[model samples]
Target: MAIGPTIGTGLFIGAGQALAVGGPASLLLSYIILSILTLAMTTSMAEVSTHLPSQHGTLVTNGYMYMSKSFAFASAYLRWYTLALFVPYEITSAMVNLGLWKPGSTIAIRLAIITTIVVGCNFLPERLFKSSERLFTAIKIGTMATLFVLSLALGLGGVDAQPPWGFKYWKHPGAMNEYLVRGVWGQVLAFLQCLFDGSIAFAFAPELIVHHAEMPASLMPASVGEAAILSASIPGIVKSDVAQTAFPYILSSLAMGVMAPFNDTRLTNNGTGSGSSPYLIGLRDAKLQIVPTIAMVAILLSAVASGRSFLYLSSRTLCAMSELGHAPSAFSTRNRGNVPYLAVVASALFSSLAFVSVKIPSTIMNTYLLRLVTSACFISSLVSCATYIRFNRRLRAKGMAKRYSSSLQPFATYFGMVISTLLLLGSGLWVAPNGNLTGSRAIRLIVSYVNIGVFSLLFLVHLFKDFVSVAEVDKQMDLGGRSYGNRAGPREPRTQKMHPHRGGVYAIPEASGASDLRVRQTMFTEP
Candidate 1:
């Protein structure tokens, strides 16, 4: 459930570019920081979600409880919009990938089929949805594992009589590739780029984990699921020829028309086609036609699965927002199957924005939306960190820090916030390479920071309606006693409700009437 959509095209395709630009050492370090951030964010969120459980709210709901409503609304709005748009983005990519095989299929017909499949999957009963997601995600992971084994076999002198190349690439490329500037600053810029790419790969894991935090019957705790998913990303990169093939090899392959550079013209190419991917290039060089064909088919399924997950994510986020009065009430409507049909439809409609790219060129469309999406991801991370900071302070305020303590409390939250802020601000570097904001550069700047502007406007609206001062926000830190929309607050322990799939009966322990906190503690707390 957690890893399904999290490691999408970014980890599958964009990782090659990261490995090419930042090298193996830089890639490892960037992912290390991201992994730590993932841990800190997930652990803190687990505490907060359990502390202030809400059926419809995600991390965004926790944000509202701990911080200002405006901040929560901004985060939710941006996140919801991003996820909605991403659905079409994924489906469109799937359609285009299909184009590689079905050259005669019209984009319109393919888009309709893709959209129908995505929405229809969500309309399944809750139990079926969960099972289906698990199966597809298992397939995706299995496919990736197969790729890893193949990469190792080839690197270890399998097929084509290639000499065994063990860690030679790292030594030659020298582990860190400079970018933009020179010396220390260039390394800093490269590291930041790696972090940004990593964040894109790790975009919505935190939001989804917040949902699992309250599900006692889940196979694994959300925090554990997050750690597993984040750990998988490292291997996804390192195992690829993107990291294994070495920089000199990549350059030489390009020279021989066997591969393209990281900044190849194919970079502008979108969709699931591996035209720009170094992984496919490496396979082609190895002359493994059968495996590449199988991988392509698997990647198509992977894209559709990601689209399905994003549909779930977007609708749920909208439902959460609607619960908080941030979206229309119609969005909160649900069917007998426990699916939010209205929210699903609304999100799908918004996802049609991907068709706009079909009309206008792919390069411009990707360039424009990618910046906005990347910036939103950074802002969302920063907001999550801030919300975690406030959540910890609230726990301490109520003297429940020991009761619901986070492993990296206080310091981790602060550190994550600082790093998130820097990434959000410096992400605009991709916008204006020469620092001259004109033409596309100017558009990129606006697109990158447009979320900030929208957030500001939303914050101003919040001020006009329910103005909250800094001191007031501080005073309202403790959510254990407050009320929101008829739901019980954190102080009043509510019974854990079973999902519709559970036949509306809560799963009991060996002894009934046992405390829910004990179950959560057993599931989440470090042994």
Candidate 2:
């Protein structure tokens, strides 16, 4: 269930685009690299989160607690809009799955209906929402399992009397495809493009797992011994979760490589629903009936389920920001059902953007949104690694015991930081260098790198505000000290003690001090 959003339309529908650009070899390689990166990132995060869980998700609270307020502000808002944008991204994908790829009145109506279902689910009572989520998660897992079995059956010639065509497409069309140009340079470009496109399937996955761990329903350790036991099991949990999520993808990629060649125009076609799917293509080619339709229905449900889960995540993220004083308090308000109704409403507003597909094809719109979401994901991953480094240092300084510690440690975090930076910087390089800056290419370039600009703007704005606040605090302290000295002849120096808690750091005055020193410390401290 924690992996619900990770396995979605991105794998089922968006992989078509990746397969189109990179061919089989690139698709397999890209996902493998991304999976390793994600595993490292998640293990590091789990180590930190298990030590001191937060009511608000670790993605929102960890930056402020372990790093700086300004970084927290920028990353939180960046994550907010990124998750918000995902609502429309999934909805658009669902529309495409429903044979409504081109923008029109029918597509618009379907969009509205699906959007309503996705957003409406979030407003349900907490128990009901959880039940629905579990149900959908089951469906997603089942669909994946079924597809994998089908892929194996089809590949081994176990379906509909068709001859075994093991790796036939891979051998003929070759392992990799050339993109924009021909030969080695083009293959390199195709691999890079696959890395970018394939990222969507695993975007924000670490954050999702951390959030799931912090949920009330999750089992929490009841004592120090229990905590130690939980900590010892974390690495196993991380590895198992990663394998469960990644193996299906790798198998599916291999299956697709055998099922349909990269050059098949149907894979890139605009409006054929499951017809564009390699699995369906293979099944239909084998003269298998009824199964493709069933698979199409499953894909459609998976998309809608993914959209609903993303809407839930986006709304909760907004609510967390409000709780942390980064957004309006009204956004944190909840109804009797314990739903953050205001935040849900605010986040749901972005789903209207799905209608933009009415003017543009859903395929193009999905690509644009995928670029933006993946860019945000890269930045967030980079920040998480940086935060973990600070957290690790603070724990060492305080000589504190960790509830969970990964063996891959500092190396993993460092690797994550380096890879994330490279990915973010190279995101737009897929646009190609033809000496002609076409309008479509220009738009793609902007969409690819726009999140970096937005993140910088947010960070600077918060940094300036923090600077002003500190200056004012210093000014007030100066005047107050002078006034007190004149009135009392001399003032006693206060002895302040630092106390670290699970929530954050606080400065407490010693009992012998003249006055209480109640300061809010945002930097990392031992818990």
Candidate 3:
């Protein structure tokens, strides 16, 4: 369920977009490249969490621990604010299909449908909501399996036609491709769009994956790993032969024609895995309605479950940031229900901005691009990860107790950082004019530089406040121990107590009595 929404409706649609742009070879190449990048980055993310997973899953909470409030705030905006306010894109994408029922339906009808789904589904209580999630995830898989069976049959029967120029033809189309006619600048924007599209899945992972195979218990972690393993292990996603044509692969079979990859209400999947809903995109058309129907239902179920989980996740992000003195305190305050009642209402209000998406003119393709959300989230996560690595190294150097990693750790951490920095820079500024850092487009071009700005602005403000001496911070950090002055008595010397509770076990409540500031900080600040 967590993974589903993060994965979004995009993967199902990416093929057509890719086909229009670069054809089979290019699309497959991009998928492989992005997949490797994501894997490395995620593994690095997992590695840090293995040592220490923050209570606040959004980038802000973890970010504030190492970075500053401004950095954390901007990151929160980049991830949560953008994400929370992203109703227009997501809901629009979710509802784009409804028009197929009544061709040329009025925007009112479409908005109503989207509104109904987004708002109505959220009204359900938590338990029933989660149960439906399990049920829906099952159905989606069953349908996907059926699609694969059909794709295999079609493949065996030779119903789908392969491109005439051979598999690699699409990869080297020059500038003549319809999708790239916008010149290098246009091409750059297009790439950014798709890259951003790819990020949708990554951001949603924390929400979706059950146990990170690393995250500690007592954190009330989420489990959307079902979808992830399913995405990874599904035969359709595997490609022993990358040179094969696109039709036979997952996208064409499941999400392409049936789901119609480019029907854009939001700038979703863009018809490519980085392009479409990868799960649906992977499956093929099954003549047996049960299979595809079940899949569609499952996709919908994921959307529904994600809505609740996201609400909880988003509100709590607001709450956690508030605890860190980044977000407004009221927004962070919780009700007796343990709900960030104000934050939830605020999130709902913020999400209403998605209504503007209704006016964007619904279509099978979207003009609005949302790649920034992906870039910002990944940037924040990766930077926090880089900080985590530093924290761990410092802890180890100081003779602190910690787990040992083999060769994989050093390589993955550094590799992820370099690659993350490159991807962020390249994806944002590799193109020109619009990205040329001059004239009216400079702001937009600079917005493309969100990652640098995210880090810089936060660092500068933290420097101004003197939160941590710039020089000392430049030195290795000690994340396991926080620095508190006389207000909390002389800071306790750094110590390790076996992490107190087991990792990867059931949740345990941390002590939160007001008298014990350390425990309160542990329950709150430690995120």
- Model 2 per-residue lDDT tens digits across residues 1-82: 4677546788876777778778989989988888889888988888877776555766687887787677888989989889
Candidate 3, lDDT over the whole model:
0.45
Predicted structure with the largest lDDT when compared to the true one: 2
> Which parts of model 3 are misplaced by more than 4 Å?
1-5, 14-19, 58-61, 68-73, 158-197, 204-216, 219-309, 323-326, 332-338, 363-369, 404-406, 428-527
Ranking of predictions according to lDDT = 2, 1, 3
Candidate 2 — which residues are off by over 4 angstroms?
Answer: 100-105, 214-228, 270-275, 433-439, 473-527
lDDT of each residue in 1-527, candidate 3, tens digit only: 22433333444433344433433433444455555554444544444444444445526544444444455556665666555644444555544433332347466665666556665544455455556656655654444455555544443443335222222222343322333346666654555444443444445443224222322321432243332343233122212212221223334323232222233312133321122342343233223335545555555544443444456556656776677566678986664545567777776665564455455434322323344455565575466556557556666767865432334555766766775666566554323323112224454556556556655775576557654544344333344343533333444543332221112222233466212111123222222
CA lDDT of each prediction against the hidden true structure: 0.58, 0.76, 0.45
Specify the highest-TM-score model's number. 2
Native-referenced Cα lDDT, model 1: 0.58
Residue-level lDDT tens digits of model 1 in 291-339: 7667767767877888888888888888867755668898888888888
Higher TM-score: candidate 1 or 2? 2
